[model samples]
Target chain A: MTPKVFYISDGTAITAEIFGHAVLSQFPIEFEALTIPFIDAIEKAEKVKQQINDCFITTQVRPIVFHSIVNAEIRDIIFASEALDYDFLNTFVSPLEQQLGVKAQPVINRTHGKAKESYENRIDAINYTLDNDDGQTMKNMDKADIILLGVSRCGKTPSSLYLSMQFGIKAANYPFTEDDMDNLKLPSELKKNKSKLFGLTIDPQRLHEIRQSRLENSRYSSLRQCRIEVKEVEMLFKKEKIPFVNATNHSVEEIAAKILDKTGLKRHMF
Target chain B: MTPKVFYISDGTAITAEIFGHAVLSQFPIEFEALTIPFIDAIEKAEKVKQQINDCFITTQVRPIVFHSIVNAEIRDIIFASEALDYDFLNTFVSPLEQQLGVKAQPVINRTHGKAKESYENRIDAINYTLDNDDGQTMKNMDKADIILLGVSRCGKTPSSLYLSMQFGIKAANYPFTEDDMDNLKLPSELKKNKSKLFGLTIDPQRLHEIRQSRLENSRYSSLRQCRIEVKEVEMLFKKEKIPFVNATNHSVEEIAAKILDKTGLKRHMF
Candidate 1:
């Protein structure tokens, strides 16, 4: 039986799904998530109990996620965390409450967690954008104001997916395949759309770390191969006039900002 | 001199990009969004001041988002409408927040009057999933253990995208094209993948309101077409024994829950 997680949010299922998916990703264990939204205090607690029972009935020991922007009283009813009463939305929402059709309340007890969100969900967008895609996305290359090109471990997929999912901008990235690297030129299709092109490069060491799990210890997965690929791709980006960024030692946040800054194209895509 | 919106998030530029793009879609209004991340007391204010000098900053009308865990004195120095002195992470993050490392703060003084975010942003994943996508994303199907099929405005897109984006599931949705509708059969792709199929349908009147903006007063845009398309497609779903839900007034929360209830397909990609 899979573990059970529940998302209890006020407004939409997206909030729950957003939290649910993220929590599940951090652990290797199998889990099942159920979302209960537009739920109030009474229903939220009841659902948690019910879901827990349901999971126990099925999976025996239910591992779970309860994600929400809920209130103190409600949080206490469901989870035993001391930070349940602590919340963050009160200040920003004061003005928009009337328009959003919700009331406001003040509750304090929680402090800022040591770190901020890493947006691991965007990785979902990345995988989907790469795996679920066909020729149609690549067809609109000219309309894309920014295009990312790089090898598999260069971080092109995550960056491009973030741009499209977050900004609504039609962004597309093409891989710098071995064929392109050997030929020492961008794909003819990408070369034609060179004005919007950008590239990403990473330290060969880090590149190997990212690829090792998937490829195993083959020659193609060697440090020497990574180094060679990095250099070839760098040369290719330069020859094609594609500005490139080195992602070693930089956090994803820092890397994305540098990329946004270098593109000089407006970064305003919702 | 585009209006400059500032994002003080700590994650990727994608956070700013999404917010920026969302704000941009409401244009005749032109604005450049300047993003500053990993902000604390001093630098946060500086970014706001710099933007004020360089561009017509909207929230400088005092925009701020912080948690209660931070000092109140800092809130005075920086402009946060809905400041959280508390932590945004709750053992887990919503995919959107986890990826971006930012959370929505309340707008205190709506004096500047930014429209509330559209239903689009909150559940953007769902919409992305339902976007017919013209078969651009076929390869990622393994990630999509569940795919949604429905007519226009049936809430299929938002639900599917939400599942995919939030869960890292490769979710795909196909609009039962006119050809499929006429034949009273599931599309060949879906028919071949029957075990993974899920369906969604919505009230015709609801569908009419949703489509009104894009089609305006055209005949195809009429309530009549909406009703017919809905009725015919629903019958088609029934004929093929496709499981579906009628997405009338239910919020995204309810819709997603109902889907989970009906399909029994798990969406956590990991």
Candidate 2:
């Protein structure tokens, strides 16, 4: 069954969605989620309440609301809505106030505010990923926190960008061309940075499917080529004593987490 | 005062960190956080317990633990640790199980699993952003979900990438160069798709600081140039009837959300 889930927040509502998804994933039910952002005023809150009530009346089911709304006046209107509300900010703030002996400061979207250093770091990391993508420029290799090495379509690009976007990691990804895989040797430019290299391997069949989707019926997407490339790349990683992960069944988030977990690389922002 | 925060998870610990940051932002207390990931095994759980105990001993106060660990045994161990734990997964899972009339699946790191279609969409969006960045490929303008327009360093690149990375929205960003700002006309390439255009403006002083960090003491980084470019871009946006947002003090997440809200663009996922 598809349950209606509303993620309401004074700002982005990303945090509510993250926690909501984590909790809701335990159940086998599917969710149709909606985000209501920038609801800092009472009028917006009243509109949201009307929407929630209308959804319940139309569907004959109370929608689930996951919110991080911090304004007490606005939050009161949402709390009065017809939904199973889970507002983490309000639920936890009061106890924290008593424990810390200080009143909670209800700033609208303060988490992403004033943290300019980390904000700039994330932006710089993304720019770095864009610039160093596919080994386009080796000039800034030294600036990379981690270098992802893999054959084409082995999930390097997405994983590299995910690392940068989520953790402020300067990730530079280089594709292992057919020539390098045939040589069974790390490229000279990457040889000096062996310690920074992390490899990614994938199932040949899966690789073929991904490649075929991009380049229909080409030799590059052929099963035989995929098998050979996967074998050689795995061999190369093993021969070079570089740690690697199989990305056939893993999401980009999972692959990135594994890389960071294994590498223990210090992030630009922690 | 600085209180220690621990984001522990059986997987990436990212969800814990995201929610932890959101909830903790309500309080004025400062936090020093450490992420302990991959604690699915009993031994790893024991190690985490010891670390938590050691941290408590060292700090003379209990740490605030935000976790998403699913394994019951491992969670039991963490629960036994000397910390004020907030395991939202378990806290909300039982109620969901009861409501759904099914036992909750206690899989480790399952939120990002088996969602291959959304994963592929995100990757494709990132690739699209890279290809169309800075008006590099106007050939594929029709495929863009949203086109970002702004003066240089108005945060088009990072905002575009964030939209792609998080929501799988194909975003193409173009910079308003000095010549284009002078003309105050939309580029011919973008004229046909004015409806998809969203503009970004920034504070001149902040823009000066950001540009000076990269290209120091240049006309591009000059305060006067920044002011003129911002004024021209705002005028252009108004004249064209294109929606815009000031990105001077906002984070990439905030800017992306505002864009999505303003555009009413349907995400490739959700």
Candidate 3:
């Protein structure tokens, strides 16, 4: 088997899948994709070195590595990792050329960009669905590119999947746990990915009303808990530099658009 | 466990999921959903009956059953199976409605009202994407209400998912197997559902060319074998009274639209 390219990025996996899928889609080469998210360049350096060595022993061709992420810590990690293994590697030049030059392949990249975002959004939605549907396979939705920080029963999963299905965005979401309210801090990862972070909050009374249907007791499903999560989470977002949207009584389209607008990401025309 | 209300159907699991999901999405219910597809309605009738009997032994609320399927044979099997043991069964009003009505809470039937033709187109599209997308899971593309169909690698899944991502339709597809070719007939069930049937055929040379990329030297990848399958299978469609579309050198959109036009089904308006 030919040694497949290793695309290591601190960016969300959806982004990696988009660009990786793009290259694979065009070229006829065996590919094995591995993703490590939330790694600042600094955090990625050591792991990147190990991945390169693993690629060499496992396959026949030189490894192709692509890294596209915004975290400076991860950027620093890539720089150090690259310095450590300078041989047996080649960089993708087109992305740089496109960034610097005008005549880049627009259509393909546009699809990749769209797919990347969509994949992220799907992940977020899947996580939300898992949380709500079966409460199994639940991951920490906090580290998501877009932590759908909303009430217990809002249409987080559908909204997330809608975002992914429509735009291919890597979206993750965390229902505000009671701990978040008492301690009053977004998860630590959300704090780290603060600029790229987004919050989804819904009305407290509505939250209580929605929850009332599920739990046997209306006490825990009271307006008090709903009010508390919404108020505390919003305050936490303010303190942690996270942007958020009020999702109470909003359709999935409206809520998703609000996040895109606040973040200034042009809704990819689907 | 509360005696759950299950809406089981014939055809693909995606259809079952859509129906199950849409039902849950609209109302507040304390029932767990277990919907399986690609199995005939008899399997569903039996399983739900067993489940309902189990609940009868434990719970006070009777199981509310909702089922939708096109094949009259399957309906006979379900009615016969359920009539013996199950007392609380409310049948779907239209198999087409269960499959089509997007927003309303469907209580009695699943009918798309020419929606099967629409779904058939979507299915054709899904089959195309399935044969093509490397490892990408286009599972959510069930919303594609139409699918294009033909031989192996005839742009079915891609077109279906494209229709879905492009235009929120639930699409699915089945292939013309060697058996279907030699026998020159759609499955008996598909024959009665002929109004819902749309066929896809392509130039042998074009199909052979597409296969060459995946399996280089097999006779299946040869234009001769391609021609044999295309000719023989198409003849069967003609003899069995089914409609088909020729697919050669056309974009997926064009082919899907052609199928839509020929089937006389209204295109999904986004």
Candidate 4:
């Protein structure tokens, strides 16, 4: 049986998950992971402890817990539970306290608490992305922090959304059609905004596989079409001297970060 | 002058930023933070070192650096810079390596690498959120993990989007109008799906300010109107014994986490 992994936090459990996943990645064994966020009260912690102990009895395997509980009482209860509990925040907080010469006050979800301007900026970015998805709002190109250029399924949409959601960047994406791909020239509107354009290219084989999954036996999903489109896109990007990244192997997060890094676009709001 | 803070990473620089901001929040000093992500090569490392040095020269204050560079060469360069560099990855990697009895692989953005299914699931959730935004797709209410019920500008939309974007939760939001607010009774459509409903209430003054920023001097933006609507929504929630949150002080991330914790609805994907 795969080992049970739980991410517990007094807040979002996002940090706990991030730290837990990173640490767990060193091991090859698989795990069934669950997230328990906003365990702010001792009563909730007690319930979680019961669940952890119950898992121990059922699986005869101690559950691995990665937690960022701010309350000492709750943390102690979880620590005493029949599980391998790692207190992510406390472990790092002490070292940080020593280095910064200040005690780390345990505030639940303090990082996420009402940075009103940042939150509003991110929401505005998300709205902008939604309004600009797939060249729907080409007239608003000037509003974008970066415009992603790619063929269909080259991952413009998800990358744009990720950039918006995570970093509050107003990302607009335009898909290059067969007509644009055949010409090997940038669209007139995009050419004027060349400085803000970032290209995404994928291997023909990978594109074929991805497209085929969505539409079986279609010409657009064919290996030949995929090859032609990918080659044209890469050539256009190179000819235009536009910086680009390969989306064949990377996740949306990686793609977004690379785009931001390459373009030197400020995240707009933290 | 505000002390400079740099987040350096060979990958997304997300971990660096998250950890750095958390630690820096303890200090009252203002910082002009910059994110330098995907500095994988020696040449880039040298460039970053120069920037760090320049910051020191310009500000006459040692910059605080939070880094998660996996490349030893890149790490060494930043480490040698005149900055208080906190190596986030290596600081914890060794302890985790010892615990797991395995060497931690220094893979840049490994945590963000393709978990294809999870990626697709998140995309689907995002699409769901967009399609269901503002109660436009009421037919799909049954598919939602949580349905946020609130008066206008009470933070239903952003919270729903945040839940979907971050946790892959299918969150749909419905707005209660004057008609619904007038009666303390739940709308018949919502009554059937009461189990999925989560209410969001905002302080009337905060709501007034938010709406005023959007539309000036309108009935919707009036303090009296905001007060009445908020009061009615809270009364409705109380009468129905519906679980709700005050979105007055918390960011969208905090609100989403609290919703997830209260509902016990598992995030559709990791």
Q: Please name the candidate that would achieve the greatest DockQ relative to the true structure.
A: 2
Give the 10-residue window scoring lowest on summed lDDT in candidate 2 chain B.
B105-114
* Highest lDDT scorer: 2
**Segments of candidate 2 deviating more than 4 angstroms:** A98-102, B99-102
Q: Model 1, residue B105: what's the lDDT?
A: 36
DockQ of candidate 1 relative to the true structure = 0.14
Q: Judge candidate 2 at residue A254 and give its lDDT.
A: 81
Docking class of 2: medium
Candidate 2: Cα lDDT at A30: 79
Which tens-of-lDDT digit does each residue in A1-270 have in candidate 4? Answer: 877889998778877777777656645556699998878788989999999999999999778888878778889989999988777667666765665565666666666535678878887888788789898868989888899999998888878988887888999999887777656787688888989999999988988988897889999899999989888888888989989999887877788888888888887655
Q: Give the least accurate 10-residue stretch of model 1 chain A, judged by summed lDDT.
A: A109-118
| TM-score ranking from best candidate downward | 2, 4, 1, 3
DockQ of each: 0.14, 0.66, 0.01, 0.46
Clashing pairs in 4: none
Give the DockQ ranking, best first. 2, 4, 1, 3
Candidate 4 residues lying further than 4 Å off, grouped into runs, are: A46-63, A72-85, A95-106, A178-192, A212-228, B46-62, B72-77, B80-82, B101-103, B178-194, B235-242
Better of 1 and 2 by lDDT: 2
TM-score of candidate 4 versus the correct structure, residues matched by position = 0.87
Q: Residues B1-270, candidate 1, lDDT per residue (tens digit)?
A: 333345543333233333223222323333344555434456655665455444434433323232211223434444333321112233123443433344523222111111223111212333345443434556544445677777765666545554554443445776755455555666566777877777788887767776785578876568888877888888877888888888775543356566766676554432
- Whole-model Cα lDDT of every candidate shown, in order: 0.51, 0.85, 0.48, 0.82
On residues B63-98, what C-alpha lDDT tens digit does candidate 4 reach at each position?
889887888998999999998787777766676556
Model 4, residue B73: displacement in angstroms?
Answer: 4.8
Task: State which docking tier applies to candidate 3.
Answer: incorrect
